[model samples]
Target chain A: MSEVILELDAVVKKFDDNEVLKGISLQLHRHEVVCLIGASGSGKSTLLRCVNLLETIDQGTITLFGQSLNDPRIDPDQVRRHTGMVFQSFNLFPHLSVLENVLVGPVRALKRKRSDVVDEAMHLLERIGLSDRAKEFPERLSGGQQQRVAIARSLAMKPALLLLDEVTSALDPSLVGEVLDLLRDLATSGTTMLIATHEMNFARDVAHQVAYLDGGVLVEQGAPDQLFTNPQHDSTRLFLERVR
Target chain B: MSNITDESVSEERPSFFVPRRKQLLVGRRGIVASTLSVVIFLGGLVAVFYLAPGGAAVRRFYFDRHDMWEAFVGNHNAGLSSVGIGIFTNIWVFLVSEVFILIFGLTIAWTRMSKSPVLLPFRILATIYSDIFRGIPVLLVFFLVGFGLPPLGIAVVSYQSVAVYGCVALTLTYSAYVAEVFRAGIYSVPHGQLLAARSLGLTNATTMRRVILPQAVRTVIPPLLNDFISLQKDTALLSLLGVIEAVNAGTIYQDTKFNSSGLVVASLLFLAMTVPLTRFTDGLIARDRKRRLASS
Candidate 1:
């Protein structure tokens, strides 16, 4: 088996009186694409947000690439740089252009020369088929195009693990195809991704491991064919039926 | 039983009233109020015109005006030698004063970021400086430096030296105000931006220098321009200290001519320098607001 790139051990997150993550634990191999699926408020997206430290966990531990994400010794900022997140809102800097947004991390975070980062950012933009829109502001682009830019931004960081927090959940139906296609391309390239999404068919097609979740608990997990065709949990069966 | 397209089932006792988009145009009363106000204002304008001294006053006002314009004209008031002297001697001092204010204000504002007990007094001092200077008018500051501070080891100088004192007084009075402006602007930047920059492994200084201050300053360009225009007008108050800036020279002409036209000339001269800046700041504010709206 490939080495584990990430592991969450009995991670628990609570907000006020409500518990969002109830002692969740999981492990993923390097270059694995794990799809997390469930109904609304299932803690799937919150789990992904937790991986990048956007949402803090109240207790337990998370390790990414042998680095303890929950360790006091770990710098959360440094951990954030190695593990990239693509937000549902696509939080591109409004003042920056598309190309500048991609270069923001490399130039500002990595402290690379502007001349150097430009070519790399340009190449990354071309990879996402947005070279022409590089000079354009995000407001000028369609929702799919902005999401593509957000992906390019994540890819620019060259992260070891990618955490996607319902990236296409905000898209219109017509724009979902392009974003999914790009994600499929990323998955095929063996980039490790933990995608928390509501799009069942896309998850089935692109995911290597599909897990069903219910109310902050991982209910069932298996290969896509096994889980969808033969769910062992009654909750999973009922949930799938509702979504269908 | 259907994907929300079952019109036949929907026909069974359901109200499907699509909301018409509401029009938010002002009513007839608002329009009447606006028209009535405009007429009243125009009537006031006509009343002023009737009350104002007629052709003689305007003829007096319009002539010998635009001295800053006439200063560059045929060598009449001062020599070409002195005009170059005026531009270089006085204008460079003005530029220096502006630069000095910008630097000192930035320093004063950033000093509040220090976490020292010694800086506690400085913070209180800076706050008091801003409040006292900003609370009191600019002219009073000039008067203090010109009249009040003179006997206390600070002899007031004349000509260019007087301008320097005026600039210094401007700096003292307005630095505190500008510092407060900078402080308010820096605080206006969202804390998330600083956190994001910090997350990039940037040091506190580098994050502030690279990300926070630049963005914050862009948002505050309008207010900064307002301060600049006010400073330029306050340059006139320097006449109390005997500095022969544009307005001061106009005052000199008024004294010689025994006419109020020089005051009008001075006001127009002040307007000439300030109107473009006012428009430019307005444009900057509008553009920033539009960009923010679009982004949100």
Candidate 2:
């Protein structure tokens, strides 16, 4: 069996009176791509945020690399260093150039040598086909370009797990294909990623396991073909029906 | 060239040509009307200045009668050898106070925004200082710091000149206002920028200094310049402390010579200094706005 890379047990998160995540449990094994498919405000984003320790859980526990992330003693910053997250808005630092955005994680936070880090960042930018635009700021790039750079920035950290929060939602329809293609490439290359997306086809095609979330509840989860072709839960079936 | 009918040509050209022709016509009419009104207003102002109570003689004396001119334009006593030296003193004080205000004001603003529980007291103190200093008139601060602090037998404050006391007073007063301006700038930065920085594992301090502050300072430049202009004008209030800055020198000349032209000259000089700064700030804001529009 593949060793578990991340585990969440009955994790609950609340914002004021709103209970966003209710007793959510999931496990991600090494080199596994898990896609969380849900409607808007269904707590998919909140769950991913919790895994990254961006949002504090009110109950239960989250363990990353077998260390309890819920424990107050464990620094969130350290956890984030290992777990990369790409947002829906593609929140690249607008002030920094494209190359600097990719370089900052290793150079600034990890205290890596700039000369060593810049080479790696340049390689990442090159792989993403953005080497020529390295000097350009985020605002100067198209939406697809910015999103791709954000993904590259996240990957620059060499994270154990990458969490994508509906990364293609803000992208134009034409732009979505390039980002998805990038994500697919990452998935095939055995990168462990947990994605929250509305794209059913993307989940079915790229995900090893497809989990459906409804109103903070994990409805059902299985291999993508099984879940898409033969959903066990009515909620999952209904969701797939509506999305198709 | 193959099918150049009059109707087709008219159809193609009217969309571009009609608007251009109409705008040209309207612009010509507007310029004529505006120029005529301005000429009429100036003529009326000239007639009033010469014909009204106190007439041309009063205007000439305060503006620049030959006798009053000497008192304003020539050598003067009360520590101002000439009007140039007096204006120079004011400019010197302004530069000194401005440098200190930006540094200390941003520091105080950061203190107000400190999230650490350990800094609760300091935050409270900063907030109180800003509120009280902003409430009290700057002139009162000049009076208190210039006159009040020295008489308590404090050696350090008592030793400085009246000009030094005035600089200290202005710095203390304006730093409070500038701190709030800095705070507003800090707040104006989008929350997403900080979130993105923190999510990248950057410490709060690093995120603030690198990501938040640079953007915030850029966004707040116009407002900061506005506060700076106010600070420039407030330097005149140092006259209350008997500093021989332009306003004080002007007042001394007015008192000894019994002519108001000295004060008028000082006013003109101040306008000459501040108007350019105001225009520069407006140009900066326009460029910033245009850049934003282009990027968006």
Candidate 3:
């Protein structure tokens, strides 16, 4: 079977008068770790947001797990189930304990039994290495700790594909390393991921492939060795030079 | 030895304050001033009464009074009289009106906060009702409900009915004021609280039920208790339409028979209801203030 699990065909999205995505096309295979590296306002995050229908595309087709996402006939709710996105702000429910926050989307939306959800939540928290902090409120946790809890919250649903929008952007410089390590672990474990990130080293060392974006279009994409080492496109070379 | 110890500083740890003497420090000024004022005022009264031109005539006029006490006790109207006939006429009206006010006020308040377009009309109606009722005097509201409405096919009610309607009118007006208090309490919650609720994938209904209203209602209770207290006193306004609340009862008693002491009795009745309410509200207010201070 072909490894491709997600594909976007000729996607275009505009925000008011400004076009944020300009006819972008890409395919993400199973167990693949892809990083979208670009400067601020370069449409990297918008592209990721479009994948799960967080930001509606003006025109395009998104296919995930052999199913078209957000189709005119398909229920948008179904697409939400297969993909979960973690935001930079680590938007964990503050009034709820970490475990309850993780269990909410599953037990409530997925209609899983409470007992079963609890077991799954513990396992997910353990994977994020914050199993002991499960009963604490989000306010009680550090930024890095909360982000991990957010990851565990999404993981509790056991999504087939995850969207990460600069997950470490809100963390302290010291705390960013620990969350990046967790993301690296998730990638190595063969979880399919599409990350729009600023951590150059993480995008360099861990990404199976890196796509550099500029002016709302994918400028260059290839195996990390080729894209990171030898630049084909002038825009890609200048982007890397600015970052490095 | 006991008698000797009592006289000595060395006795029983030299009791810093001899048991009953503790009162001398805390209440000395109040007791002395109140006692002296009463004595001095009474002394002046006796001098005035004894020295005044019609002193003996005054004594004769006062001492040989009719059997008014017997009339007050034996007459069925007297029970109503002691209640202040005017107040008795309207107390029931006040109570029934207040009940309707609570229901409708809470409804309007909750509606005002709703997102529905239908609720907007209610919100606007509430604003208009509160504005109109609050702007006009209570007497005007009484006239409208009791006298004015009757001419438009509503039956011309008895003073008792008018009084009751008056109470209803007042509560209707004040309940909106009270509802605003509740709305403020609900809105004071931080935004993070709601965002957390939404991201849980909870429907808006469930979010309000589980997380929002409960917390908001906690801050609302103390202020509500205060409004209830004020409502009790405001009920006196019903006397204008002729229900015999305590004040009107005293007025009626004073008018029917010749005695001014009924005024004192009426004051006592109001103080009876208001004092406890004020004390209780003050205690809660104090506790809440302290909590707020400590939190800050």
Residue A142 of model 2, lDDT score: 89
Interface RMSD of 2: 3.1
TM-score of each: 0.70, 0.90, 0.62
List native contact recovery per candidate, as a fraction of 1: 0.21, 0.54, 0.12
Q: Write the per-residue lDDT of candidate 1 for residues B53-150, one digit (tens) a residue.
A: 68556655545445334432323444311122233334445566788899888888888765557779888777777778778777887787667655
B123-146 per-residue lDDT for model 3 (tens digits): 788778767766887667766776
Off by over 4 Å in 2: B1-55, B65-81, B282-296
Off by over 4 Å in 3: A1-3, A66-74, B1-204, B207-296
Number of clashes in model 3? 16
For B215-253, candidate 2 gives per-residue lDDT tens digits of 898877878888888888888888887777777777777
lDDT of 2 by residue, A98-217 (tens): 999999888888989989988899999988888998887788898999999999999988999999999999999999999999999999999999999999999989999989999999
> Can you write out model 1's per-residue Cα lDDT over A1-244, one digit (the tens) per residue?
6999889988999988799999888888888899999988999978887887767899888888887777768776677677777877776655668898788777777778999888988998898899988887777889999989988887888888888879899999899999999999999999999999988898889888998889999888999989988999999999989888
Using lDDT as the measure, name the better of candidate 1 and candidate 2: 2
Docking class of 2: medium
Q: Rank the models by TM-score, top first.
A: 2, 1, 3
- Categorize the docking of model 1: incorrect
Please compute and give the TM-score of the first chain of candidate 2 against the native first chain. Answer: 0.98
lDDT value, candidate 2, whole model: 0.86
